[model samples]
Target: MSDIRPKYKGSLLRPMKALSFLFREPATLPMEPREASEVYRGFHLNDWEKCIGCGTCGEICDNFAIRMVEIPDLPSDPAKGVKARRPAIDYGRCCWCALCVDICPTGSLSMSREYIHVSRDLDSYLILPDEAGMHGENFLKGWAKSETSDLLDLARQAMGELEPEARSDNFDEVTKGFDAQSALLEASRCIQCGMCHEACPAHMHAPEYIRAIWDGDMERAVEEIYRTNPFPQVCGRICTHRCESACSIGRRGDPVAIRWLKRFAMDQVEPQKVQEIALKNKVSKPTGKKVAVIGAGPAGLTAAFDLAKLGHSVCVYEARPEPGGMMRYGIPEYRLPYDRLDADI
Candidate 1:
């Protein structure tokens, strides 16, 4: 076979053409940093003041690059659901997905436009960012949370309740408790952030119970509820739920139905079963100690309950016909049914 391709004819001038560019100006731009895109996913920037230390960012990070570090000097208020911790980012493992910023309930986490960080020290790659950039220099905000970018289910499930006209005729409980389906749907909304647990006065294990409820284990949910609270039925009905206020979801949307979820769990279990669960941890041996509680109100009864559980003999005195203090004598029956209060007592 004959080759049709032509052979190349080399030129002496072509070899010298390469040297012509050396005399001309260089084509490449200067090696200096330039502005990045407005919404570029770059280094992290956290507003420590706005961050509640929910650790949602750490939980959502697929690479496990975010870690919550305790800052001893930072203020912590359990009632407000604030923690003395901050997130530290490991750039080596980060993918710059911006998911941490989108899921942040407080909108305190965002990416900065300045992304360059060149260092020989390995520890410099990991940083606890504040408003300043990676090098402690101010940078423009990059990707951040917006209504369209939020990943949380802000709107909670609608609660079932009796119509005003229907409730006007009788003193029956106006708010109908959640059904199994609605309860599960509502429980799924929780991120298990533990914010509610800190905000609760009893320090109730809300995240544990909510997860149990979502898993469809009514008995386990009930058990978790009774761990810190003895009066589930009463508290579920009328106690002020500070936990809801501290709910991370409530920052952008309606908070989870924590109070109603408690009521639902209590309603699902039998009264006898609830009583058994509540007393499951009571001391088997009597301590032979006798204690007298002045009143049979919530506080006094709680004291008595604790005392009795510790194998101590406790006696409660009540001036009124019933032992519920303001919960019984003050709150209307329509709001809190007497039968429910009795079950709690």
Candidate 2:
């Protein structure tokens, strides 16, 4: 019978076969860094020129990886809602969520395609990113803020008003003002950034009052309104709302109806209640000072209100039958009703 087992013959050339390919070129190409996708969430990039430094990004950061760093050299204009600060990101805690980019009111924050950040220094991980990338290199932007990705409700709640035809005959106010439901909806849109407060000529506590209105506390809203301005009804109806112009939310969408919200709060609370709230902190002891202000316009009345609150004898003199300055005489009755003006006075 033939032997079933095969003869064992070891090849001497097997060990040398592995060395033959060592001199030959590799089949795979050299490993080079590949470009990331267009929308890759990578390192943060901020346009310092466009950034208002509202810190909305830092506030929305769930991981607390962002902080506002004050830069003294940066222009700080509160009336324009610009702060002299910028966001500093701690990459170690950041999850690359791109939420800051989506919620940035000015659309200044974005991510870069270049994500390769290797460093031996621990301080390098926390950086205040600007227009330049991590290494001060110009990189393609990725994961930028788009209309679809914006978290802010840009469109403002439409306010109801009297039709032009319906009010053509009478001198009643044109704007019907915001109702309770509309007021709450409008007030809820405020991010409480205090931009409105800074922008307001009177520096009214708009954020506080708006929050109060959102919380369904009309009295509290009135109290907040009266903290700075003596005439809520007047300003609510006739005064130009510069606060709206400086509103952070207005960067992309219609600004919060600050004027309308103020009107709503004033309308909801009774005049007596507002007076009580306004005078709550008035000085108990009389100052025994006499202040006589000529003209019963807004300016004069405001001065009188302050003087009276300080426990002084205050009197206002007016030439016309009524005193509202341009608010009553110059402005049309359709825009500002006399009754509301009277209530403010």
Candidate 3:
């Protein structure tokens, strides 16, 4: 053996060098709760107002720890794409993968910095999070949806349009309808947040119908659209599309082509079948109450349709000789053909 022990050179000073650190301030951290990093994923904190109760988080939860429970007090407007439900998390099974945070349509769900929880009660781990933290301490946000981790398709599928030369020569439909694949792809982009419902004056069931279209259930989609909107054909073509303006996906990307989806649904169903679906819920018995609508525009017609369904007699008075006020007269022929407008009415 080569005398390895003899190779130590000035090693006696190494032990003394360690003592120098002893005189320096000792590394210490306060036991008190400290703020986590800005992007740290901790406990969930949901904004109930912004949450649409779409239950998408539960679906994406690979651990199956999330469940959508109906909170009856919360608004459950199907027409608006809101369910009377919220996510109840079982933390015992949570991996904190943050999938829910990234996929949230409205970005209402986020994680908080404060994550401490110690209790004998097992139920405490099962929480329905709100704006407050796990203990209502209102901890500052940690992890939240960001551009980097966004799961929604931000870019809209470009709809094809006829060239100006091709369109101007004849008053043909300007935008060619979305093919089956295009419609399905567009429908898949919806996160079902229901912001469109809130923004729509007609409160159309955009999410439900959009999902129906994606699921390949055209008739079901037609039915869902008819729930709130009686003139899908006309609205699909020429409505100002306030719903698209409020779409949650629109915040980060092109709002779901909601108007186009509606158009696609209306186009799939035959005029006769659509007429049958629209009148499916009409009351069989006469209510003896009569309603007089001033115009045949979308607003007045929508009200008349509902009233008629509730067993009330509706009499619509249109100033124009043709019933469709703006849809028939105001909108250009290429945008909404007279035949399509007739089919809608």
**CA lDDT of each candidate?**
0.91, 0.88, 0.85
Query: How do all the candidates rank in terms of TM-score, highest first?
Result: 2, 1, 3
On a 0 to 1 TM-score scale, where does candidate 3 land against the true structure?
0.68
Q: After superposition, how far is residue 160 of candidate 3 from its true place, in Å?
A: 1.1
Better of 2 and 3 by TM-score: 2
lDDT (tens digit, per residue) of candidate 1 on 241-316: 9999889888778889999999999999998998999899999999998999999888999999988999999999
Can you write out model 3's per-residue Cα lDDT over 187-301, one digit (the tens) per residue? Answer: 8898876668777887888889999999999999999998877888888887889888767676556889999999998899888888889889888999999989999987787
Model 2, span 303-341: residue lDDT tens:
999889989998888999878887789888887888888
Candidate with top lDDT is 1
Q: Cα deviation in Å at residue 274, candidate 3? A: 0.7
If candidate 1 were superposed on the true structure by all CA atoms, what would the RMSD be? 7.5
Q: Model 2, clash count?
A: 0
How are the candidates ranked when ordered by lDDT, highest leading?
A: 1, 2, 3
Clashing pairs in 1: none
